[model samples]
Target chain A: MFGKVVIYGVGLIGGSFALALKHKHLVREVVGVGRNPHAIARALQLGIIDSMASTPEEAMRDADLVLIAAPVAQTESILAAILPHLEPQTVVTDAGSTKSDVVAAARAALGAHVAQFVPGHPIAGREKNGPEAAIPDLYVGKKAVLTPLPENAEHHVERVAQAWAACGAIIHQLSPQEHDRVFAAVSHLPHLLAYALVDDIAHKPHADLLFQYAASGFRDFTRIAGSSPEMWRDISLANQEALLGELDAYLAQLTTLRGLLAARDGAALNSVYANAQQARQRWIEAIEAAEAPPPPPQETSE
Target chain B: MFGKVVIYGVGLIGGSFALALKHKHLVREVVGVGRNPHAIARALQLGIIDSMASTPEEAMRDADLVLIAAPVAQTESILAAILPHLEPQTVVTDAGSTKSDVVAAARAALGAHVAQFVPGHPIAGREKNGPEAAIPDLYVGKKAVLTPLPENAEHHVERVAQAWAACGAIIHQLSPQEHDRVFAAVSHLPHLLAYALVDDIAHKPHADLLFQYAASGFRDFTRIAGSSPEMWRDISLANQEALLGELDAYLAQLTTLRGLLAARDGAALNSVYANAQQARQRWIEAIEAAEAPPPPPQETSE
Candidate 1:
């Protein structure tokens, strides 16, 4: 898909992209940029990328494709730093979880050339982080949402789709606002809830004992609770409005549920439980039908 | 440890226990009793049990130890049916999730003989069920709570504890009430919440689209929602009071959270998120430290 590619932040997503590029022969030369020299060295040693760029600008100097995979808050600053060095013909996109901020940052950084940039979010990752956590098939059968700018070139969008396709992603197109709203419900909100649930249980009087008794159900539900606090903090803040809206909606429903249970309203509780059960079944069937393998069993050999 | 062991339910728990008994060299013979003749035959064919008994009465005729592993609602009826057949010297016990109900049933059915019937709950299982999901080390490093009758004989209690110890379980003696309350927070209540969450999402106007965009986080959060509805329904009904209390409490907290999010109270939201993150981390660390290899993943070698 491209001759040379530059990834600005080579963490889990970035590192996995590098691995996928290798798998599909999508790019010939891979350049990585990260703040930590140790991580850069590790990525190079692990063969995640071919070389390390001394700076963001240096990374994009000879690259045909530029991917900003930094934290959402850092996207604007990094884009600012790399824009001056980018070739006019270069194509740029991001692998951020949030879209609005990144899209706005790209517009401000590239101005008239903003069409070259596509804001995208790959709906795949693990609780684990860093380049070491990157796996070869990280994006296999996953959804990658692309929010193309009004001026985005058709060829550029096509190339972006092609790159994601090579990485084993099914592409979905939406506007930046729609992408943010959808992800807030599908991803961001769930993460926030997981974190909140963990916190609620941890601060309880029987915290240690409760944790001791936490079985597979609790472990699975709260798995994302162990995510990078810094990254989640940034995401929670960046997508605050939509995430908060989701939080409120979930809470309102939960409150109504609480009332039902308190009143020993068996019919109401049973109705909700049955509905939830059926919904989850349909979702599971949809997932299974997609023929996507689960991320390898946790703590098992990948 | 046991010469003739009778398991009163030839399903996942009983069958797995039989396999574990053989694996640990704790029993000479495992006699499985089930209402379903086909399940009994399947259990024997799978080598989960050495022999099959058509009725609990037949299975307990010559058994020195009897473990009832039936569904919560059926425990009382099964106990009543098997009580007359149990030898006075038999060390009877149960592997039910909800202790109080099972304990009450044991007391009602066996009267003074209840002292021989220890109510136990093993905190382990897989999403999959049946003898097919049976693994010998299913209880290894898992918690097994025993709620013995207050007048239980020392020898009977010690025998039950030893049996669990042989299966590599960490045994704890708990009051039935305590067991129910604790598990309500850690296990039952969480399952209820998961089912409710998934149901709410499914009923949403955009359910299909929401699911299409669903990623690992939602999948993990709602994983328990895919659990056997029949089993959970029985559990929820059995532990109704405590589960309802926990659910109400959770709902209240969720409502408070909604208020904070609706107002975009960043500080409050941050506190909730941070607390959850910290709690989840501690819980995971504790579990990892205590784990002794999860009995090998049950990957069917297709």
Candidate 2:
């Protein structure tokens, strides 16, 4: 648990982190730092943090941990800006979707102290924005991916893991490159596809009628399309290589499906659907099983 | 208003239609039919219909209107089986997803009486099944597409339109083929994609880890994938041609996107996302505006 945590960029993730810390009695003081004066005021009014600091340096002065939660594009610059004021023992970390660039920036800015930094990504957010949307239970039962905690100290990694555990997050460790590639397939590329589909639908001449006929299926598939463009633009850029790779794979699969459909190949379509059906069934089962409590151990002769 | 209507297959749509008819004082008698004896008993217990019949023919014996609300694949056979008992004056219509096939089936089954059979598709259904999922407002603000009416009695088409209106649906007319093509793009292909994606994820060796990291975005996008597989399978087969065309178009677009991503063309990616953003924004705006009340008409006293 973090005794004193300073959260940078009091947006959705950062604000949620403050609440989760409070829920677990994990932190004594929660201070927020952000560029927007109004957002800082609102976060204070909403009681998301105990206090506000005018600058990142001011916020991290005596903090045991510093969590830089900001737009991916701004993460490196913020890390560089805040490095000079960090305490030698303070564990610096970030909650950014993309990690490679941020890790490189942290190493450059903090030098030897770079070993204290842990790059993490929490897979949770809503289309709605601001501190108001932050819920203490947002991170509960969610996965938090930590990329390559430096070999500097076991205590540092343990402390970071404990912070995530307090918020009810299951921690998974991977290299920064692995983290990027995996998320590109699961998250970033899907978001890009949703955005593109929505745009295509909008530009159609029969847009109004088409949307009117769009069922809950279309609405749900395109909900992420309603997300902030600026944030996604940065993410799509930061993880370009992996995202492109994923996009190619998905397109190749889509093309095969199209071919089957075009030929009116019922047998082929059925095979594809059956494969998908079995896959989804397994996922659904896995999710349901995870929600249930663990089974008691079987009795055995000693 | 229908003085007495017989609803065949008293499931979600049929049960909801019973409620709507009662609410609008459109029907004096609402007889329900189901092949299953238990389902008939259950419909009666739920007060979704005034009485229950064992077969579609028996239900329509004395009814002014006969509504076929069964699955799309069963539409033709059900029509064929009921044709012998139909009254010449009765206004028979269907509420299936694919209009052309059902319309063709009606023509084949009922011969000249097919003119009384208006092929329609209602754009309403939850991820739920059965009468218990039935709600009076199920079709409220949803679209009900009626294919071009056959050269028959004008009053028959008017009767069909009124039925949908009473159920709180906005009526739109299109050719049977047009309805199938449009819905193939907006509904069928989207569902296919969702099922495939969820299936693919399920098959991954690290599926549990992937699912644990699944957020609300993925859950929403894949909700339709949780739909009744048999039902979706039937729809996929019924609208094979148009659905295939849509699949091809969608694949082509995805291929182009993949190419741009592979090339690491930031500008192209940015443009794609920008278009998607603008399209979705306009769609939301249009939908909102439609849901709002119309402005008062100006009077010219010249």
Predicted structure with the largest DockQ when compared to the true one: 1
lDDT of 2 by residue, B194-271 (tens): 777766666567666666566678777777777666567777878888887777767767777767766666677777
Relative to the unseen true structure, what is the C-alpha lDDT of residue B63 in candidate 2, on a scale of 0 to 100? 71
Docking class of 1: acceptable
Q: Where does candidate 2 stray beyond 4 Å?
A: A1-4, A22-29, A35-38, A41-56, A100-111, A148-152, A168-178, A274-282, A285-302, B1-4, B22-57, B150-152, B289-302
| Predictions' DockQ, in order | 0.47, 0.45
**Tens digits of lDDT, candidate 2, A213-233:** 787778888888777776787
Candidate No. with top TM-score: 1
Estimate, for each residue in A6-100, the C-alpha lDDT of model 1 and write its tens digit.
88888899999889989878789999888988888999999998998886667777679988888888888888887788787788889988888
Give the candidate number with the greatest lDDT. 1
> What TM-score goes with each of the models?
0.87, 0.86
How many angstroms is residue B79 displaced in model 1 relative to the true structure, after the best TM-score fit? 2.6
Clashing pairs in 2: A199-B276
CA shift at B33, candidate 1, in angstroms? 3.6
Which whole-number lDDT from 0 to 100 does residue A67 have in model 1? Answer: 84
